[model samples]
Target chain A: MEKKRLYWRICCVAAIILSIITFTPLVIPQGVSKPELGGVPYSLWTSFVITVLLVILTYIGTRVHPGMQNEEEDL
Target chain B: MIFWVWVFGLIYAGLLVFASLRSYKKNRSSEEFMMAGSNIGLTLGVLTFAAALFSTFTFLGMPDFFRINGVAAWIFLAVSDGAMVFLLLWFGYHIRMKVKGMEFRGVAGLISRCYENRLAGYVFFLSSFLFLIPYVGIQIQGIAIFMDAAFPGSFPAWGWSAGIVLIMLIYSEIGGLKAIIFSDAIQGLLLLGVIWIIGWACLSHFGGIGPMFDKIGTVQEDLLSSPGPQGLLTPQFLFASLIAILMIPVTQPQFTTRIVVMKSMKTMQLMAVSLGAFAILVILPTIFIGMYGADLYSEYGRDEFFANAFLYDQPDAVAALAIIGLIAAGLSTTNAQIFALGSELRGLLRGNENSIMTKTKIGIFVFSVIAFFFSIIVIDQLVLLARVSFAGTGIMGPMIILGILSNRKVSPAIIYLSLTGLIIFLLSLGGWIPDMYFDIRLDLILFITLGIAAVISHLTGTKRQLIRPKTKE
Candidate 1:
């Protein structure tokens, strides 16, 4: 259970970091849409990837969140 | 098209009536009617949440947003939604645990109990009313305008708005929250189907994604990047938007109620994940439709773009489907918001069960009437108005989160500060005060300041952790 808690914390941190990176110049550099992946604009594609990653992290979160372990007792 | 409209319209109306009748009960408890008996499953939970979150703002507003803004518009909503669901998982668990042994009222009641203050509840309810009613109104107006476009002179816009409010009131009065959820499920599916069909038709205009961007590039090079033509989706705007959207489940009573009423922790957690995927699927197509509009209707007005792209630009059957789908989109959110306000009012009421239910139904009627008036008088960009609504209610996020999550008897200072912040934000919206302070957006500043104050209040407040009541669910 402790191990699952640690993993959930990591997922939380990763999601936060991914969200922070999304607003940075690396992802949303002003007036730049270069390095297109298959012709999708840069900010659009990169942020799209970030969105996918956040959703993936959320799925992982559902499995490892420590509160889920206490449902029989608490919920 | 009119033939198909009658066919689809009758089918939609028949389904709504069926849902209402199925959920109606002669001896229903107030809890059952107001809270759907607190047993929503994963699919229903997800559908209701998605349907409420993505409405006319999405169906019509998004493509229009893209047509005006640029690719960065994706970040403004889709990325924000992605982060929101992740936050939803964590927030949902805490709130669910908080309400496990108690009768879950609306957020207003929950926070009032949490802080031991009626004022907190009133402030929460006030923010919800001030923001959600206008948002609901504009969405109703959106449907009205679209209906007028579809049938040139059959009924005035106000006539359509009145019809919508009547239908909403009838079903909600009959079946209550369960019926709302039932209708939400139908609308959720219909919204997805209609959006994808329209998106596919739009994408086929350019042959594929690459050619689509290629065509847009020739027409408007600025659209391919951040802060497109008009420069609205700047990082600051997008970041502030992310925070506001993230706070939806925390502070918005409609979503907060949805979170608390889920069948189990597992179900709510899974619903968050599913809602994320749903957000992606729903918003992805809006980009295609938006880019299609940007390519073809670049210079058109908002109403013209919607009519041509969603109606005249499609085959008759698809256009008919679009009209029905748009109505479904608008109705679900409208009923959810207006119903939620009534639920908030019920939380604040002090009386017997039957009396409370009676007043609560009256409250719902009054709120719907107010929103109907707003629909007739309110007119603005759907997406921008929606963001304002989100930001407005989101001002209460820190207080509510502290109320729910802090085991300590936190100071009520945050509550009053939240109320003050709400007023300041309102003043800014009224243009009585500048919305920017030293280059930071006022909403962002308010969010950050209240968030910090909540942390301090938690630290300094007295600890009074009570023994956990036995699990009752």
Candidate 2:
């Protein structure tokens, strides 16, 4: 359970980091649309990648979240 | 088109009737009536949450947004939604545990219990009513506007709005929250189907994704990048929107109730993940539709763009399906908000179950009537009004999160602070005060201030002592 908590914490941190990264110029470079992948613009493609990653992180968070056992018992 | 409308409309109405009848039960317990027996499974859960979250706002508002504001609109809603589901997984656990083994009242009721204060509940209810009513109103207006375009000179927009409200009241009053959930599921699927059909049609116009952007780049290169033409969708605006949307599950009673009513915590968590994927699926197609609009109808007004793209441009069957699908989308969301208000009111009322149910139903009726009136008068861009609604209710987020997650007996100062924040937000929205100071948005500043105060309140709070329920005062 403790190890699960640690993994959940890591997942949370990674999610938060990804969210913060999205606002940076590296992702949403103002007035810049080059470095496009297959015709999608820069910000659009990068943010799209980040959005999917966050969902994947959420799926992993569900797997390792520490409170699931207690909650299941309550149910 | 009208022939197809009748065909699809009758089919949709039949499904709605079946769903409500399936949910109705005689002599049902108040718990069963108001809370759906606290047993919603994965499929229904995901669909209801999606339907409620992405309404006419997504259906009509998003394409218009992307058309005008450009690609950053994706970051505005889609990215924010992505992060919101992550927060949902974390917040969901804490809130579910907090309400475990207790009667799951609405968030206003549960937060009041967590804080041991009635005013906290009142404040929460007040913010929800203030914001949600107008949002619901505008959604009704959206449908009314579209209907008027579909059948010009048949009836006034207000007539359509009234009819929509009447149908919502009948089914919801008969079947309660369960009925609302079932309809939401139907609407979710319909919305997904109708949007993709229209989107695919639009994409076919462009030939492919590569040609689509290449074409848009020539028409307007700014549409291909951030802060497009009008210079909105800045980093600051998108980040602020992210916080507001993140607070949605925390502060919105409808969503909070859905979280608690899931069959188990596992389903709720999985629902969160699935909802993220669903958000992506739903919002992606809007980009194609938006790019299509930007390419074809760049100079058209909002109404013209909607009519041509969603109606006149499609085949008779597809256009008719758009009409029914739109009604389903707007109906599902408006009813969810109105029903949630009724639930919030039920939480604040003190009385016998039967009387409370009667009053709750009355309250829902009253709210629908008010929203009907609002639909006639409210006018703005659907997406912008929605953002205001979100940022408005979101002022209560810190208070709610602190109330639920803090095990300590925190002071009631946060409640008053939240009330102050709510007033400040309203004042700014009304333009009685500046929305930005020192180049920072007022809403963002308020979110930060209230969040910090909640942290301090928790730190200074006394540790709680549990007393068995049977021995409680």
Candidate 3:
């Protein structure tokens, strides 16, 4: 149970890091000259990766939850 | 195209009515009507939640945002939405546990009960009303204008708005929450299918994703990066938007109710991930369409741009399907919000179940009428108007967070502070006060300040922790 709780906290902190990077001007400099990866700009690709990371975090959060059977039984 | 549009529209309407009729027999009590049996499974739960999340804003407004704002719009919405799904797991577990074995009236009422103060409910409801009604109005107005643009002379914009609202009211009144969820599922599927289909066409027309962005970058280089030409996606604006969108499940009654009604924590957890996936799939196409607009429709005004990009540029069948998709997008979202407001009122009323249900239905009608009237007044810029609504409702986020996370009796000062913040945000939105303070967005400042204050109060005030999940370290 403690393991699951710690895992949840880590997932949440990772989510916060992703949010900070994506929404702030830190990842992408506030200028016209931007970097690119392949055809997409680095800024756009960075945010997209953050979005995907969030989804993965949710997947992991679900997996690490220890009370899944308990919750279903409660239902 | 007109023939096909009429055919599809009629068929869609028929399905909504059928769903309502199917749910009508079971909706004999307020609980059944309002809660939809509260045993919703994974698939239907996901569909309903996704439908409510992506509305006409995703369809029309997002493309327009992309057209005008550039690639930053993706981060502004899609990234924020992804963050929202993550919050759903932690927040959902806490809120569900908080309200276990109790009948949920609304988030507002639930907060009131938790804080041992009725004013919390009113403050929460007022925030929701001020924000959601305008948000609903924007959805109606966006589709109405697009409908007029798609099928000229078919109906005036107001006429289209009134028609959709009336249809929503009739089915919702008859079938209640179950009908709304069923229709949401249908609408969700249709929205996904049509968006992907159109996205594919746009990509193919431009010769795949790489070549499409390459062309857009050449034509409008500023669009491929942040702060496009208009500088709308500044760091502050995007951060504020992140906070606002993240608060949707926490503060918004429609989503809060959905989370509470899930069959199990497992379903909520899975549904959160599924919603994030749906957000990506649904929003990916709007970027293509918006980039298309930037390429071709640069000189066109809002109405002409949408008409050309969404309708006049498409084949007859696609355009017809686009019309139905827009309507489904608008109706699904508007119904959920207006119904949520009704449920909020039902939660507030101190009466028997039958009487409360009757009054709640009447409240839904009145709210829809107000939204229909506001729809006439709302002009273009669908995404911004919807964002304004989100930021507006978000003023109460701190209060909700404090209520859900802490078990202590809330200080009245916190409630009063939240109310004052809500009024100031409204005034700022209305231009009665300067929208920027110290060169920062008023909403951002307000969100940060209230958030900090809520945290301080929660730490210093009465320390009662009602939700202590099993933790062994």
Candidate 4:
């Protein structure tokens, strides 16, 4: 239980860090620069794809549970 | 163009009414009606939290903030999500255990019981009631404005606002929380679909984000930056805002009841993480779309940017979709707020379960009527109304923190301390306090007050008394 709690905390921290990093380029007020994706600023494109990725991750995460529920027992 | 929007709006309204009526029939007892029998599973709980969290504020204001403020608004999601997770893991679970079989009459009741302080609970109740009605009024106003924008001549703002209030009252009065939650899930899904469609259409219109940001790069770079136009928000402000955002779910009576309704700790955890993740998906797109709108329509003023851009120049389909999304957001939030306020009032009246349920119905009716009336009066600046509502609730943060600390036998003096802190914070915002106080932000004031309150509580040795576990009735 302790280990799982630590792992979740680490995951949350990592996610926050990743969010900060992804957020960095935009925060530096150099004016709205084109997002560079391999040579193209993937501004909307990256955001769209990242949104898709986040949605998928959320769906999967919601579905996975350690000892979630037993339908028969509740019934 | 407007005809199609009217059709969609009418259909959505009808569907909401049907759902409410159905849920009302299913509500056999007060427990079933208010808390969904305390058997809400992971899926429903998550959906409820996400739907409740997104509301009209996120639907309309988020994109507007993004357009005016830039990426700084996106940080709110991160902070709010973190807060939700922390609440579920630490505070929510304990609160659930503490109040295990008892129906949370309201946040006031819970806090009063928790701290053994009836006066404190009453104060919380009064504050919540004072703020929530205006808050609901803002939502009703949002719905009216959206209707006006979408359907124009089809329905007057007053008529549309009344219709919305009527529909919300029907479901809320009938099914109570069950009706609200079920409808919220549907609305949540619809809003999500609307978000995707708008995002996709905007992307396609701009030929993609690359070209869009390229335009932004040439026009203004700071639009993509953290603090954006307002040099007002600093790192300290950001931290404070994040903390404030976290406290929202905790302080909100509507949200806490959802916490109470969950089946188990594991379900609560699942719901929290899922709600956070879903929020990022559903809400972030609206912000991006707003950014896109900013780039597309650079001529407009900041406040009118999002509404004007989407309504004026966009393709008919895109305009329709945006309007639909906005309506869904507004309605979802308004319905929940109405129910929440109703529940709070019912608790304050100290009515019996059946009486409380009936009073709750009447409360929803009265609240909706007031909100409908206010919508007409404040139709001009819905966004400003929304902000004022948020600031009103901001006073609750310190009070809530003090309440929680007081639970641990912290001094009642902490309540006064936090109240003083809130006053100073608000005054500072109004420029009543000179800025020379080491540039202390409002958020900083709250933190310092809380810290002092904590120290005083500790020194006074007024830690909370542990209650003996009572047997379930």
**Native interface contact recovery, all models:** 0.75, 0.75, 0.57, 0.16
Return the lDDT, model 2, position B353.
85
Worst 10 contiguous positions by lDDT, candidate 3 chain B: B464-473
Q: Looking at candidate 3, what is the lDDT of residue B415?
A: 90
Candidate 2 or 4, higher lDDT?
2
TM-scores for every predicted model: 0.99, 0.98, 0.96, 0.83
The order by descending TM-score is 1, 2, 3, 4
TM-score of chain B of each: 0.99, 0.98, 0.97, 0.88
- lDDT by residue (tens digit), candidate 3, B1-473: 98989899899989998999888974377888899978788998999999998999999889889999888888999999999998898888889877777778899889888778999999999999998998899899988888888878978889999999999999998898999999999999999999887878777878877788789878988888788889888888899999999999988899999998888888888999999999999999998888888889987888898888878889998999999999999999999999999999988899677887779888999999999999999775888888888888888989998987876665777799999999998787778999998899899999999999898888777766465445321
Please give, for residues B390-409, the per-residue lDDT of candidate 2 as tens digits: 99999999999999888899
Backbone clash pairs for candidate 1 read none
Among residues 3 or more apart in sequence or in different chains, the pairs in candidate 2 whose N, CA or C atoms overlap within 3 Å are none
Worst 10 residues of 3 chain A by lDDT: A66-75
Candidate 4 overall Cα lDDT vs. reference?
0.63
Off by over 4 Å in 2: A73-75, B467-473
lDDT of 2: 0.93
Off by over 4 Å in 3: A24-26, A32-34, A66-75, B464-473
> Which 10 successive residues of model 2 chain B have the least lDDT summed?
B464-473
Which one is best on lDDT? 1
Candidate 2, residue B468: CA error in Å?
6.9
Clashing pairs in 3: none
